[model samples]
Structure formats: C-alpha cells, structure tokens
Target chain A: MKTWTIKLIVGGCFILALVVTVTSFFCNDDFWKVNAAQALTLILTICIAFWATQLKNDVRKKKEHAEQILKKIQAIVNNDGFYYVSAESDAIETQKRMTMTFRSLNNSIDLLKKYGQELGFKVNAEYIEKEFKDYRDFVSEHITDVDYLSRSESTLRKHSENIDNKCDIIIWGLY
Target chain B: MIVINISKDFTDTPGARYKSEGEYSGELFRETILIPKYVEAIASKSQLKVELDGGYGYATSFLEESFGGLAREYDIQEVLRTLVFESNDEPGLINEITEYIKMARRERK
Candidate 1:
C-alpha cells in the first residue's frame, strides 16, 4: 500500500479514538469510560504495529527490486548478460544476439525510469545509450578488419566495459 | 508518406555491414531496397518512412551502412529531411540511425 494510504489509516484511527474517548468521558460512568478508553488505545496500538510492519516490507521489496535491476545492469557491463552475445558468423545467430541486446538495454532504461522516479532519483539514459552506440559502431566499423581484428576486438571490449562503468554511475545514483 | 517495411519487403534476417560480409548485408539493403524506395519517394516529392521492426535484430554496421550510406550518396540534410524511421521494437534505433547519418561524411573522410 502507498505511504499516504497507511498514513491515512493511522490518521483515521487517531480521529476515531479521540472522538470515542472524549464522548465516553462525557456520556458514560467513570469506570466504563476508563475501560473503553483503555481498550481503544490498545486497538489503536495494534493497528499502528501492523502498519509499521507493512511499511517495512514495502521498503524491503523496493530495495530488492532495485537490486535485481542493478544485477542486470552489471551483467550488461560485464558483457555476459543473457542477451549480450558474441557476434557470430551465422547471420541468424548474430541477429538474435543483437536483437536481444537492444531489447535488454531498452528494458533496463524502462526499469530505471520506474524505480528512479518512484525513489526520487535522477536517471540519465544518454550516457548509457551513447556508450552502447559506440560499442556497436566499433564492431561494425572493424568487422572486416581481418589484419587488425585482435586490436579492434580489445577496443570493442573496452567500449563494453565503459558501458558498465556508466551504468554504475547512473544507476548507483538511484541508491 | 512512402512506407518501406524492411521485414516484409526485404529479408527480415538482415546480416552484417558490407556485401562481402555475406547475404542480406547492409550494402545489399542500401543498394537494392533502401535506395530504390528513397529515389521513388524523392521523385514523388513524398517522405519515405522506413519501418525497422519485426526483424530479429540489426547490427550497428547494417544500420549505419544502410542509412549512413544513403546520406553519403545524397546530401545528409536532404536524407534526414526526406526519410523518417519507425522502430517501435527498439526506440533507440531512430536516434542511432540519426547519429549514423549525421556522422557518415566525417567517418567516410
């Protein structure tokens, strides 16, 4: 439940307890009024206790979800994410890898948007997007450089690593 | 608008950057599919919309070569103005293509 909703529940209970206690004092016998006030206080205390537990659970779940997204971003940075595949000779395999990578990156952006906005953090997607574009461009530019493939591959790997660092900066800011 | 559905008109399984790389290459797309439609659109004074969804995925080379190569042949500004790209599957693709077109000449030089 939303923080506001929980707060509203607490507020409503407080109002109810105050009205009941005040009315009992004025309208009931001293012994009955005292017992009624005590009972109402106990009920209010239990409600608050439940509300606190629920709030803690909500915070924990949000943290875990953030961590899950962080792990995915880490995988992309490590160049070993499920979608991050080596460029293969087979066009079909290559296409599959590329498609998945694109989708994965896009999904990361979406996840960051949701979590960051909810958590009141700034999300800058430009850096990651540019880094990915650079990596892809490097691969395409040097795909046929057979004589210097190793050097080009290293440069490509560096670009991928750069993406990882950028993610840390952007996504870590959320925390 | 003149619409070119890449997945339908051309091979959905697009390959690498150059023709020498293999079948369904970016060079092939540019020379065969993209350029012809572009020319027709130009002649008709209509904007060409290149739909880039429904494909497995595109290599950077394929994307760069196809759109960037077009910019190389025509004025980059004209190419940018005349062509519109739609990639619902990958929203970033439009920006990537735009960058490729913008940098085509510098890279070529």
Candidate 2:
C-alpha cells in the first residue's frame, strides 16, 4: 500500500478512536461498557498504526535497493562511453569496447531479473536484453559506415533512456 | 581435451579477417595456430577446446573468418563435433561462431 494511503488509514483510525473515547465519557450511565468499547478501539488504532509504519519502512528499503541496481545498469549502458565504430577506429579497440560493455550489460540484466522477480517488480528483462543485443549486432555488421554508426549511437542513447524510464515505472509501481 | 588458449598461444589482440588486414588476423590464426591444432585433435580423435578468454575481445570478422574458414576447409558436422569452445568471458561468442560456421557451409553449397 502507498504511504499516503497508509497515512490516511492511520489518521482515520486516530480520529475514530478519539471520537469513541470522547463519547464514552459523555455516556456516564453505562460507564463500564463505554470504557470497554473505548479500550478496544484504542488498541485497534495502535495496532493499525504500527502495521502501517512497518509497511512504509519495508517499501522505503526496497526502493533504495532498486535504485542501487538501476545505477549499475545505467553505468553499463553509458552510451556516451561507447567507442564510435567507424573506418578510422581501430578494429581491435572497437571490438573490445563493444564486447566488454555488451557482456556487462547482459550480466546486469540478469541481476535485475533475479532481484526484480524476488521483489515482485515487473521488469521487462527480455526486452532490455534484446535491445542491447540488437545494438551490438548492428554495430558488428556496419562497422565502417559513418552514417550507420551515427544511427547506432543515437539508438544506444535512446536505449539508455528507455532503461531509465523502465526503472522509474518499477519504482513507481511499488506505490 | 586438446586446449588452444588464443591469448596464450597467439596474440591477445586478434584483429580482422585476412592477414593483409593487420597483424594477428583471423586468417593468420587459422593458418598458424587453429588449423595445426585441429589436425592434431583429429589424428588423436580428441576434442579441440578453444579457450576464448584472456583476450582483449574478438571482432565478428575475426571469429567468423577463423571458425567459418575452418568449416569451409573441413566437413561442417565434423568441425562442430570435433571442436568445443570455452568462452566464459564471452559465452555468447560461442553461439555466434557456431552460426558463422553453419552459414559458411551454406554459402559454400
């Protein structure tokens, strides 16, 4: 449940408990019965408030964990760090740069899937994996073309942005 | 298993397809290192395990030319059966090389 929703519930319970306690004092003719009713409502309110606090703490911890994982993914998908694969670029260096980053991204996606599944987050792991692989394959096939290289770089930037958006959805979905 | 560590046996920085392209070219590797070891494995009836780690990284052209050229020289199935890959650093390269090997045979036919 969302923090706001939990806050609302706690607020409502507090108000209800206050009203019950105040009314019981007014109904002095049935003193014992009113006291019993007031005690029950107060206990119930306290229980609900404690439960909400626990839930809110758990959500906060999970969000922090998700952010850490997303940061690692972002670093792997650092599009700006990619080597421009062109005629001038050394073939050995280009291959090294592409393969290392691509493999690291694959590993990150695997980690994301494992944690996302464990945490009940709906991660589009397959889509992310496909996007990374497609970009690598396109680079491999069109290494010498400046135009194609430019396009791949743009696509890579977009892919990185897409990953950010996806992570945002997962974080927001927690609410 | 007859092992061939490319990084150990040949250059760690393997380059493009043909020897004319540059040093440590896939063609050079196939001729100098891969083919001779493959021949020995065949004679001994053992698997040639090509360890594709400890290297900088491989170009698609390098992988395709080396393994695909091997498939071209030998029966495709025989090459596939005789050669096993150990590429823990980049496991995906194994599949990529396998596809290139298969495609090279198809192109030959």
Candidate 3:
C-alpha cells in the first residue's frame, strides 16, 4: 500500500498499544510502570501522527508544484502563446528554464500568427492573448484551465470586433 | 514519423547565431525550434526526424539535450540520424531532406 497508509496504520497501532497499556495498568495492580508506558506510548503516537501528517502535506505540496510546472510547460508547448510566471519565482535554474521555455513559446506563437495573417486566417492574436491571460487570471483564482479557456473564448467571441486589434497586440507582446 | 534533419548550419544564420551567442546560449536553438516543432507534429499525428550533422560541440550538446527532453516528455523514442558532415548551409541539404521525408512517407503508405 501507499506510504501514507502504512504510516497511518503504524500510528494507529501505537495508539492501540497505548490504550491497551493503560487498560492493563487499571486492571492489574501495576499502577506506576504500566501508566508510565501508556503515557510514553500515547506521546509517541501523537508525535508519529503529527510527523506523518507533515510528511503527507509536504508530499502534496511537492506534487502540486510539479503539476504547476508541467502545466506551464505544456501550455507553452501546446502553442497557447503565453507564459504565466508565479509571482513568487524560484531559483536560478527554474527561472532560466521558465524564461527559455517562454521565449521559445513566444517565438512559435509569433511565427504561427504571422503565418495565419499571411494566409488570411481570421486569428486575432491580441484577442486570443487577452482571453488567454484573462483565463489564466481566472484560473489563478479558480484553478481550472478548461473552465477558464471556455469562458474566455465565449467572452472574446461576444466582443470580438472591438478587441480584435487589442488581442493581437497582446499576444505579440507575450514573446 | 516525420523526421526533420536540423544541421548546425541551419542555426548558423545571423539571427540564430545572435540568439545562440546571446546571454541565453543555454536556451539553445533546438529548444526554441525542434522541440516545439516535434511536439506539434506528434500532437497532429505526424512524425518528425531531426537529422543532426555531427555529434560534437555546443550545437550537438544543445540538440542532444533538447531531443532527450522532448523524448522523455512524450515517452516515445525519437530518431536522430547523425550526418558525417555539417551541410545545412548547402542548397542541396534541403533537397536531400525532402527526399528523405518523401521516402519515409512512402514507407508509411
């Protein structure tokens, strides 16, 4: 089973052991020794549970961070044309990687946008970028890309003409 | 799979050279071009071949790393055909690559 499950099991066992020790002390006349053992076991159990919970939280935070990084990378690779850096940036290596990935994504978007314009494809970069940014902002609060993208797309479509040029400029600026 | 051979000479153009020699040489051209292109091609149900001219120097290192990163992310093996000589600047290189692509397409058929 999972490590967390194992920890929980072990922690439960310690609590059980403490309960048994206390009960045995109350039943038999060995008041001092059994009570001491029960007290120690109870403290150890609490400590173990606290540590296990901390470890689980740490693991969860790490997984969330990794997923966030992957999402940013995937967004760049998927030709979304925007890179959103967390307000709290990390180390030099992370910054370098993020910058490089953003630059690359930016270039690709520029190339595609240029190609679309040349081909007379009705893709407004500014509109798309704004919608994407707004969606990203929404997701920052809501944490859902699909919902954000859908809502932004609908909103952009509703106000397309006025924001067409604006959206194109925003996408170009992202690079 | 559509494999596009990217030679060091392809990145020797003034724009590419400037970008490479700039403060972000670690960023590399392949990371900028080949990796995204490969990902795009794959997502669109196409194969990409990145033909390398040689397996040495800064250009090679960048290409290798970029290819490895893409491969790892995609979880699919990629082909990196190393040419004995660097020839991206040569006019015939494009033609040679076009032929290779054509042959691969035919094999797929």
Candidate 4:
C-alpha cells in the first residue's frame, strides 16, 4: 500500500481507541476511569498530529527526490549523448524505448566513422587544407579576370577578403 | 526498368549499420541518394516478396518504405540474366546508378 494509506489506517485506529476510552469513562461513575480516559484521548490526539506532520514531511521529501532525479537527467542529456532516464518503477515499455534509442545512437556514430574511412578522403586537417587551397585558387583566378574584376569590384574584394581570412585561420592553426 | 544487382558479398556500411541496426543490415546504400516524389510512389507500389535471398527483399522493403518508392527483389540468377552486369570495380557504375535512381524518382514524381 502507499505511504498515505498506511498513515490513514494508523490514524483511524488511534481515533477509534480514543473514542472507546472516552465512552467507557462516561458510562461508569469511577474517578480513575474519567482520568484514564482523558489521558488516553490526549495521547491519541498527539499521535494523530504527529502522523499528519510525518505525512507532510514525506510529501516534501518525495518532491525533492523527484527534482533531484530530473536535474541528474538534464545533466546527462547536456553532457552525454541522448538517453532515456529510467525510474526505479518505470514501466516495461519505457525501459524498452530508452534502450532502443541508445542503441540507435551508438550505431549511427559507428557508421559515420566507417563511411568516412570508406571514402578515401580523411575528414581532418589535410582535407580541410586541400579544400582551402582549391577555394583560394578559384577565387584568385576569378579576381584576375579583367572583365569580371571590373564588373564586380565589391564582390571581388569580398571574395579576396574571405580567402585572406581562411589563410589567416590556417596560419593560426599551424602555429 | 533499371535493375540493381547487389552482390551478397556487399556488407552493410558502418553508417547503414547504425541507422537501421535492429531493422535492417543490408548492402543497399539509400543514404547517398536524393530521390523525390516518384521514388516514393514506386516504393508504395512495390510489394515485399520474400525468397531464398530474403535479405535483399528486406533491404528493398526498407528502402521502399523510407523513400516511398517501388522495389522488387529477384533471385540472383534471375537478376544476373535480366540486368546488365556492371562490374563492381567500375567507379562509373556508382554514378550511373545514382543518375538512374534520380531519373526514376523524377519520372514517378
């Protein structure tokens, strides 16, 4: 049973006990009986109040626990790869889905590396440098064309500036 | 009708393994192609027929489903007889297949 249900049952029993004691005292004309009844009722009242306080504390603790779990999941998502955060009491379907997604991501990353290798082109600094050189040559050739240069001076200037920036980046990397 | 005969020796590329891991593990590289409307229509029309070379059929089914195009799996002997044999060693065949796929996709669209 849930924690709340257990608390309710225990509280009900304490109240019942208090009621019976008080009723028995009224029925009898004994002084001890009345005093005992009063003492029992006071004890039961205190027990009920204590139970209420515990229930409140339990609710607060649960809320804090859930928030902490959420923060952990968020941290994982941001730092690590995408994955499902399974709760202790998560349904079977939820666990299955999380597993599937994780597997899929793992496979994709693996395949990407394989494809890069298969294509003789290395996706690294050497490839980037070759591409930059080709781009620079293309821009220089276009800029040197008298008709093209005359017609679009601003555009040519922009292209040359971009090539210069790329050269600068390459030089910075080398150093 | 352009028929592509992929050899059994062709294994799933690392990329292919990742994308369709649980679902498919075939040699057909659908990721490299850019097919539009017609490809989708062809896939939708193609019925999945399983045979001894059922792996090809499964891969075709996956592509058909993904691209929304038609795909028909044939026996190795039947494929060899009907389709023009393109040497796997030829780099041009890749381009040809890409072009044919694009053309078929366009026509279907």
Best model number under lDDT = 2
Candidate ordering by lDDT (highest first): 2, 1, 3, 4
lDDT of 1: 0.73
Residues B32-84 of candidate 3: C-alpha lDDT, one tens digit per residue: 67666666775776655555433222221233234433443443333233212
Candidate with better TM-score, 1 vs 4: 1
List-wise, what DockQ does each model earn?
0.35, 0.21, 0.05, 0.03
Give a tens-digit lDDT track for model 2, residues A1-175.
Answer: 6989999998999999899978987877675654768999979999999999999898678767766776777666665666344545665566567656766766566666666775776446556656666666555454434455655666767767777667666656654
* Candidate 1 lDDT over residue span A27-90, tens digit each: 8777353477899998999999999999988876885686677678668657643223344344
Cα deviation in Å at residue A40, candidate 1?
A: 27
Tens digits of per-residue lDDT for model 2, B3-48:
9999999977776678766677788999999999999999999999
**Cα lDDT of model 4 by residue, A112-134, tens digit:** 23433433222432333343334
- How far residue A59's Cα lies from its native spot in candidate 3, in Å, is 0.3
Per-prediction TM-score? 0.63, 0.61, 0.25, 0.22
Error of 1 at B87 (Å): 1.5
Q: Which has the better lDDT: candidate 3, or candidate 4? A: 3
lDDT (10s digit) by residue, model 1, range B14-107: 7778888777888999999899999999999999999988977677788888999999898898899999989888777798799999998797
Off by over 4 Å in 2: A4-70, A83-95, A110-123, A141-175, B102-108
Error of 3 at B35 (Å): 32
Off by over 4 Å in 1: A1-69, A75-91, A110-125, A142-175, B105-109
TM-score of each candidate's B chain against the true B chain? 0.95, 0.97, 0.41, 0.24
